[model samples]
Target: MPQETTDEPGVTRPRITPLDIVRTLVLVVALATLGLWGFGSWTMPWNIVIGIGAPVVVLLVWALFLSPRPVLHVHPFLRALVELLIYVGVTLAWWSMGSAWAGIAFAVVAVTSGLLAGRRALT
Candidate 1:
């Protein structure tokens, strides 16, 4: 897909690089794991609901707000905010599940990938 850059740094990279694709895939995994965390965090009946709902909600939010040219077509700042929310949400979800190391590791990777991706956009 063709790409257009915004005034922000790293917004101008090619439509998708290998790193970008991998980062995106990893984010999806975080979302999925977050769903599992949600499921396990709750009681029986609620766990079932959370397991099914959490990932679906995250996926929809990503598609609607974070994805490029999403259906909502939000402003760049708003898009970035939504993306941050997702990233933080997943990170916290992991932490809340008593996986501090996993949370920290994912946060480091997510932040690094985000910075690198943004830097790539700037070039």
Candidate 2:
């Protein structure tokens, strides 16, 4: 499918990049995790250290050297998997969480987002 993008009429639109999807996923994961954790519903000892910490570190280091474009050498699924794992880890951390519904919801959303992004990146 041809990827439609926002344009400035006369000016070409800045094409969306794989990194943009990654960044979008980053925001989604960060917000979702925080919302879950903040609600006092999800608490995993190492989840924060891994999920939150690692992404920040990776993004910071990556930004120091990388420039973004519509074309990305990295695969979208890999990026999504990393994010999904982080959130999954966080969800798993809360062993005491009685309800299983929330985790399922998060998983569904993550996977759906990942697939959409992967397809977009490919095109």
Candidate 3:
């Protein structure tokens, strides 16, 4: 694995790869889709509020704290935490809508992707 070495001899950063880029794009698209699906599935006033508000709120949050150029300038672990929270929340939202199969599939993908990212960070 390629390591991102620093000026100091032993310190290094996780080397970002093409696969990482692809994974990031996948997550971004998934999050956007989840936001749309979640809000669109709501009832009545919630539908009115969430249908319009959820996408805006989620995208704002993503741009602020989760994106590569986060406005908040958070730590990588913090970024990862936020990502996991959103992913799991979306999974639960699907499950709540009685889409058990979709929920399970999404959960599996999200978890597997997260683990892969974590492993790369550790390496």
Residue 77 alpha-carbon offset, candidate 3, angstroms:
2.3
Q: What is candidate 2's TM-score against the reference?
A: 0.47
lDDT of 2 at 96: 38
What TM-score, over all chains together, does every model reach?
0.76, 0.47, 0.65
Q: Which stretches of candidate 1 lie above 4 Å from their native place?
A: 1-16, 119-123
Instruction: Residues 14-108, candidate 2: write the lDDT tens digits.
Output: 77777577656655564555544444542576655554664465455334322244234455555555556655654553333554676676666
Cα error, residue 57 of model 1, in Å, equals 0.7
lDDT of 2: 0.55
lDDT per model vs. reference: 0.78, 0.55, 0.72
**Whole-model lDDT, model 3:** 0.72
Tell how far residue 90 is off in model 1, in angstroms. 1.0
Clash statistics: count for each candidate: 4, 0, 0
The best candidate by TM-score is: 1
Off by over 4 Å in 2: 1-10, 14-26, 29-32, 35-73, 93-96
Q: Write the per-residue lDDT of candidate 3 for residues 77-122, one digit (tens) a residue.
A: 8878887887777777777778878777877777677778767756
Clashing pairs in 1: 10-118, 10-121, 10-122, 12-121
